[model samples]
Target chain A: MTKKLMKGSEAIGEAAVQAGCHLFFGYPITPQNEIPEYMSMRLPQVGGTFVQAESEVAASNMLYGAAGSGERVMTSSSSPGISLMAEAISYLAGAELPVVIVNIMRGGPGLGGILPSQSDYFQATKGTAHGDFRLLVLAPWSVQEAANLVQDAFDLADYYRNPVLILGDGLIGQMMEPVEFADSREPIKVLPPKTWAATGHNGSKPRSVINSLFLDPEELERHNFHLKEKYDRMERDEVRYEAHGLDTDYDVLIVAYGTVARVCLTALEELAEEGVKVAMVRPVSLFPYPSAAVREAAAGAKAVLVVELSMGQMIEDVRLAVGRSKPIHFLNRVGGMLISPDAVIDKIRAIEDGSSEEVRHA
Target chain B: MLETVFSRPDALRDVTTHYCPGCTHGTIHRLIAEVLDELGVRERTVGVAPVGCAVLAYNYFETDFHEASHGRAPAVATGIKRARPDLVVFAYQGDGDLASIGMAEIVHCANRGEKVTVVFVNNAIYGMTGGQMAPTTMPGQVATTCPLGRDVDMAGHPIRVSEMLSTLRTPAFVARASVHTPLLAVNAKEMLRRAFSYQVAGRCFSLVEILSTCPTNWGIPPAEATTWLEKNMLPYYPLGVFKTPERGSREPLPLEG
Candidate 1:
């Protein structure tokens, strides 16, 4: 297939269409509106439905119903938008419904500026809504990777019968790059039969119920345990990361993800000119985070610098991975601001120069 | 030899319900079950239960059911119906669940004219949470939250949902009926039947608002609760058809010619 130029947001939308996800319910939010815009036009052409929901809250609930009916459905929003979807996301998780959510994250504790930030690291991976549940969170650093990961997300969601999130940021959503399209005619990956889908059993099979309410305390706890077991399998089998310069002896290791990871890649190359042997580890799946990869990448490094758009969120995960063995330094740009490669290089120099106690908990 | 006058609808579970003795939820539940059975849509029907007294509705209905968060039944039903247009979908919601918290979901669903049936039970007060005030609670009515009779100035006048929704140009069916009396119960069931039939015909968005009773929460006898609903709730929330979209075309009426 010939590769075509595309924006990250549009690529994701196109990927969903190609992956046979014809149902999309979404609300417009900054840095991610192109996705819904694309779907609104494209889905109808393929005999699909694209509903611009009244709010992210409604959009998420719409996903719950669509997934329950055994159809591939998707939704995309920014940080605050995803936060608004917390209630329905919990329902989807508890109900074991398969749906894909794309978080083109922007800065926030509350309506932080809209440019782009990785502030939602904990929200996406750790927990956003209530109950003991987990979403398979995938982080992609480039337009091509974002598109590919979205297609993979659909398959993974159905395979696990759980929500799968594609965690991106404003930079990726706004940037343009070449990406290969999945041929729409090609068959998608087959998932196990969703016998429990409420697809009008034709009065032949038993009624199909899609519910999350477990009133009996023991019954609820058993459901929780079942979710935990599924998460354990995901943690074991689905960890994805990129280890750069780890094979060689490097003085510093940088932990970053999504857009920040792409910027860190450029910084590492520039540092090579100055004889600053810097390696990097970029987490591909933020949830079930690539901790083992972080451990391996941190080995023998003098210090690990974690770069992010937030003040310090992913850094906490990095600290856990390195844990007292290596000094962990952190740097960020918040409130919708994008960090330049030069700014990252400056941080690397400062950490190397040992002139700044900016190292978190230093 | 004699024949039975009544048998439980095949759509209702053999097990008992958890609603209080005086609650009208059981009566309404039976109505829906009977409709689904009569239409032969029982197996294919999917009901989205609400977050009020009917939270465990999945246990009562033999057909598939989903428990929605407060006021989100409409949104959830939209999702299910869109994904499986062939399946019959309905939402069972109460006053607090629909009028109070899920107002947006319901309004948007009504406006978009989604192909789904909504069984809205307006009992005037929050029953599951021990008789709290609801968006539908009438003026001069009292509840746990309103130790004094509801003050119109402080608490605001009650919202008439069916009337408000009738203003929207998209719905195929919007009606308000009651189950407070035997005659009204039959009328309420007929509205529900029309709502489900509209959905089955693929005519978008149907909702039937039922004037229900909360005897336990209202501090009245179960029989008195029905009389109370007739006397107090009827005048405030008048019963009748609010909106009905044309069956000829399911598309939104062209922005007024």
Candidate 2:
């Protein structure tokens, strides 16, 4: 199948429709409104459902209700909207319902400006809701990757019976690239048996209920324990990462993901020309973190430099992976701005030699 | 031989409900089940349970039911209905759930004219959370939170959701009735049946707000509770149908125009 050029957000919408996701619930917000708009046009054509929900809270809850009824459902929003959706996400996670969420991150401590930023890193992986649960978070760097990951997100959500998050940024969302829709196959319907779906007890045994209530402490503990077991199995089988130039004997390594990783790769190539040996490790699954891979790479490097478009959130994960094995440094820019490749190289070089005092014009 | 005292509408769950004695939640639950049985939609309907005292309603409702957090039933119901429009869908919510935290969701759903039914049970006090003041609490009503009597100056006036929602032209049907007495209970049932009929007719946003009693929370006997609902709450939240679209209407009326 030949590929056609497509924007990241457009790819997500197309992939969702092709995957037999009949419902798309979302609210219009900057950086990710394209997904909702695309769905509004396409879903109707396919005889599916598309709704600009009243708010993020309603949208996420809508996803919950749809998923509970044994249908494929999804929602998309940016950072602030995702924050509002946290409560519903937690309920979905608690109930162990399968659903997909797309977070087109923008800069924020409050209502940060709508620009591409990896600032929602912690929030996606950790802040879904106040609970012992993790959303399967996928960080896609390129537009094509973002599109492809939506299909993968649906698969993972169904496979694990949990919420999956496609974490990207505004640039990836807005950037147009080659994407072949003709190459995409019809969705493989691998839905689990509806033993627990709320599809009414017609001819079957009384009825199957979907809920997250545990009145007894012991019962709740058991529920959490089961969820943890599932998570542990996933951690073993689903850890994904990409190593670039790591085999080469490098004095420093750069760790990043999503758009930041793309910028770090460009900067690393520049550092190589200057005779400063550098490598990079990009995590595709942020929740899984690719910790073992990073730790193995860190063992041989003198220092690891982490660069991101946030106030050093993912860097903490890097620190956990390294753990005194090597010195960990951070280069960050906050409030919805991208960190340039030059700044990353400068940081890496400074850490390598301990002589340079912040390279200029990065 | 024991005659069939239990309705055929009910699923064979022998466990008695956990509702307070003399509360109307059980009556409403039975009514919904009976309607589902009458229409043969029980096999193809999904019900959403909201917070308040009915949080565990999935236990009583034999159909495919999902429980939502406080006030989020409308959104959840929207999801289910949109995902499976062929199936019957309704959300059962109380005063605190539908009138308080979920006010935005209810209003927006009604305004957008979603093709679904809402069975709103309006008991003047918050039943689940230990009798706190609800958005529909009548003036001078005393509860755990408003122990000094509901002061309109301190706690705002009661919200008449039926009237407010009826003003929106998008909804195909909006009505309010009470179940405080046998005669009124019959009216509430008919109102509920009409709301669900609108959904069956594919009309958008049908709602029936039933004035229910919380004798336990209201600190009154069942007789007094019935009398108070008729004398006080009914006057504030008058009972009647607000709007009714034609049987086959599909076009949504613009709320603004």
Candidate 3:
């Protein structure tokens, strides 16, 4: 397929179609509205289904129904919208239904600003909804990756029979980059058996029931335990991360994800030019967080600096990964703001020069 | 061969119901199941079970069931119907789930003319949560939370969901019926069957609200709860077919868009 320049959100819609996604239900929110808008026009042309749901709550539930019925279903939203969809997300996970959700994260503790931020790291990885369940979360650093991961998202969702998330920021969704589209015919079509689908009972079999209710305490506990086992397997087999300059000793190691990883890469080049050795570990899969990789990288570095566009949300995860083996630092800007490469480089130099004291707060 | 009046349809599973004794969820569930069986769409039908007391409906319905959040069943049904136009879809919800937290969802779904069905059971109070006051609670009716009687001045007026939904232009069918007696249950069943039939005919959105009874929540005997719905609840929420577009019925002006 020929490559074309497309915004990250638009690319996601294109990729969803290529992946045989016939249903898109979403409520428009900042930075990612183009995803639903694009589908609203394109899905109809292909005889697909697209709806601007009443609210994020409704959109997510619609995803549950379509996905449960054995269709390729997706919904996209930002921070506040993702929060509203949390309850449904938990239910989808509990039911073990395959679905894909895109979260173009924006700022917030409440109704925060509509610009890009990575403040939802905890919410995405730690399970936004109630109960013990994990969504396969992928963090795309560029528009091209955003498009490609969406296709992979569907495969992973179906393979695991669980919800998958493509976690990006407003910057990734809004920025335009060249992307190679997947061939619509080449993508996998591993539909569940007809007996599993709700496609009216033809003389072949009786009706099928799909539900997530385990009212017995012991039975519910066993189900939860099995969920933990599945998450554990996903953590071990599905973890994806990118490493730069982990071969040599570095004065500072940076941990970042999504668009911030790009900023960190640029900072790494500038620091190398000044004879300061800097390296980074970019997490592509945020949930099965590249903890071992970050810990190994931290083992050789003098200090670890976590860079994000949020107020130290991902930093906590970095601290947990590094433990007390290395001192950790944070560089971030919140409320719809981004940390420039120059600012990150300055923090690196400060830590190197001992000007930045109190390495680990805790 | 003798024909049975109330045997469980092939569309419904043989699982024992989880509903409390004399609770009307079973009757409503049976009505919908029988409708699906009658329409011969049980194999290709999807139903969304809402929160509240009917949360486990997916277990009883032999067809595919998607459990929706409180009051969001219509929206879920919309997704299923839109994605698989060949399939039949419906949502089952309660008063607190639909008229309270889910008001915006059901209202917008009706307005969008989504090809789906909704089976709403309005018993005037929240049953699953131990009998709290609901949006449909009568003006002076007493509930666990409204022990001193609901005050219009303090608690505000009860919302008539059926009346409000009928005001929307897109819906093809909107009716309200009670299931306090066998005769009333039959009438509610007929309304439910018609709603599903409308979906099969590709008419428009259809909804049937059953004036159900929650004996435990009402703090009265099952018989008295039926009496309460007739004496007090029915006056506030008159039972009838508010809108039927198939019969050349249109929603009143100013509210239709």
Candidate 4:
């Protein structure tokens, strides 16, 4: 199949449509508006539905309804809009409904700039809402990867009966790039029928109820334990990462993800040309973090440098992965600032020269 | 064989309900169940329950159901109806759920003319949350938060949801009904049947706002609560059809006692 030139947001939308997702309910937010805009135009042509909700709060609930009815549904929003969706996201998790949510992140504590930023890393992986559950968070570094991962996200959500989050930044949503989607109109995996869906009974079966309220203490506990088992299975089977320069000797092992990892790749080539060996581990999944890969790679290096677009949120995971084996240095640019390739190379050199602080505070 | 005239509706489950004694939620649920049975749409009906006294409404109905968060039942109902337009869908909400927290959801769902039905039970005060002040709390009505009776100067006037929703541009079926007496209960059931029939016909958005009694929260006897609702709430919230598809006019048709 020939690669088509497309905007990152549009590519993600088309990928969802090709994955058999015909229902989309979203509200417009900067950096991710293209997704809803594309769906508004694309869905009707394919006999799909696109509803522009009054707010992200309503949009997410609409997703709950659609997902409860056993349809492949999705929504996209920016940082502040995603905060509005937090309540429904938790409800979706507790209800064990399958849905895909895309957060093309912008900066913020509240209504921050519309530029590219990875400040929502913690919000996506740790505290998406006030619940003990977790979203299957996937971080994509490039437009092509974003498209591919979105298709996989739907399958993963259905496979586990959970919500899958595609964590991107403003750059990934707005940038124009060439992406190749699967030509065949087939899903990546054969999912089981949603027997738990709240479609009408038709007198052939018991009434289906989509609910999260377990009033009894023991019953709620049992539900939590049931959810924990699914999360445990994800940790063992879904951890994904790409390791570079780990085969040869390296002084600094860089840990980064999303667009920052793409910058690190460029820095890796530059450092190799300068007779400096630098290995990098780019985590593809943030929740089921590549802890073992970071630990194993850090074991072969002298020190580790963690880079990101926020004030070092992922560094905490890197610290947990490496433990006290190696000194971990942190570097970040927050509030929509992008870290350049030269900046990453300089950080790596500083670590190699022992001039950087032993422990950079997050 | 003995004749059965008052048997349980086929749409209702055999299990017992958790509704408080003297509460009208059971009566309203029974009316809805009867409507589903009469329409012969029980097999393909989906209900969305709110986060109020009727949160467990899903358990009472044999059809498919979704329990939505507080005030989000309309949006959830919209989802179900949009996903499968062939299925009949409705949202069961309360005063606090519909008029207070979920105001935006209900307003937008009606304005969009979504093919769904909504049952708004306005008991004038919060029920499940220990009788707090609701958006529909009557002036000078005592509640947990309004211990000294509701002060209109501070809390403002109660909202008339049916009248407000009827002002929207979309053509819909909007009505306010009361179930304070046996005669009124019969009228309320007819209003509910019409609301569901609108959805069954896929005609337009429909909502039936029923004035109900909360004997426990009102601190009154069940018999006195009926008289109290008629004397106080009925004067403020008159029973009427606020909008209809046939008329397409904003003039309310107030019913005579």
**Candidate that beats the other on DockQ, 2 or 3, i.e. the better one:** 2
- Model 1 lDDT, residue A18, Cα: 87
Give the proportion of true interface contacts each model preserves, from 0 to 1. Answer: 0.76, 0.85, 0.66, 0.78
Considering TM-score, which of the candidate structures 1 and 4 is the better prediction for this target?
4
Ranking by DockQ: 4, 2, 1, 3
Q: Write the per-residue lDDT of candidate 3 for residues B1-257, one digit (tens) a residue.
A: 99878676987778898787768888888888887888888878878888999888888887776777777888778777876888888888999999999999899889998889988899989998998999889887788898998999999999988888887767478888887888877788888888888889998899988898888888888888788889988887877788887553453222111
lDDT of 4 by residue, B35-60 (tens): 99999999899999999999999999
For model 3 the local lDDT of residue B214 reads 86
In model 1, residue pairs whose N, Cα or C atoms come closer than 3 Å (at least 3 residues apart or on different chains), thus clashing, are: B71-B102, B172-B245
Query: What C-alpha lDDT do the candidate models reach, one value each?
Result: 0.87, 0.85, 0.85, 0.92
Chain A vs. native, model 2, TM-score:
0.94
TM-score of the second chain in candidate 4: 0.97
After superposition, the stretches of candidate 1 with alpha carbons farther than 4 Å from their true spots are A184-190, A201-206, A358-362, B1-5, B246-257
Minimal lDDT window, size 10, model 2 chain B: B248-257
**Runs in model 4 with CA error above 4 Å?**
A360-362
Q: Score the docking of each candidate (DockQ).
A: 0.65, 0.77, 0.59, 0.86
Candidate 2 lDDT over A98-120, as tens digits, reads: 99999999988789799888888
TM for candidate 3 is 0.93
- Order of the predicted models by lDDT, top scorer first: 4, 1, 3, 2
Model 1 error, position B91 (Å): 0.5
Over A45-106, each residue of candidate 4 has an lDDT whose tens digit, in order, gives: 99999999988999999999999999999999999999999999999999999999999999
lDDT score at residue A274, model 2, on the 0-100 scale: 86
Give the clash count for each candidate: 2, 7, 3, 0
Model 4 chain A worst lDDT run, 10 consecutive residues: A181-190
Q: Write the per-residue lDDT of candidate 1 for residues B1-257, one digit (tens) a residue.
A: 89997999988989988888778789999999999999999878888989989888888988887778778999999998888888899999999999999999999998898999999999999988999999999998998999897899999999988878877767468888887777778888888888899999998789988888888889989988878887898888888776677533222232110
Error of 4 at A169 (Å): 0.2
Give the higher-DockQ candidate: 3 or 4: 4
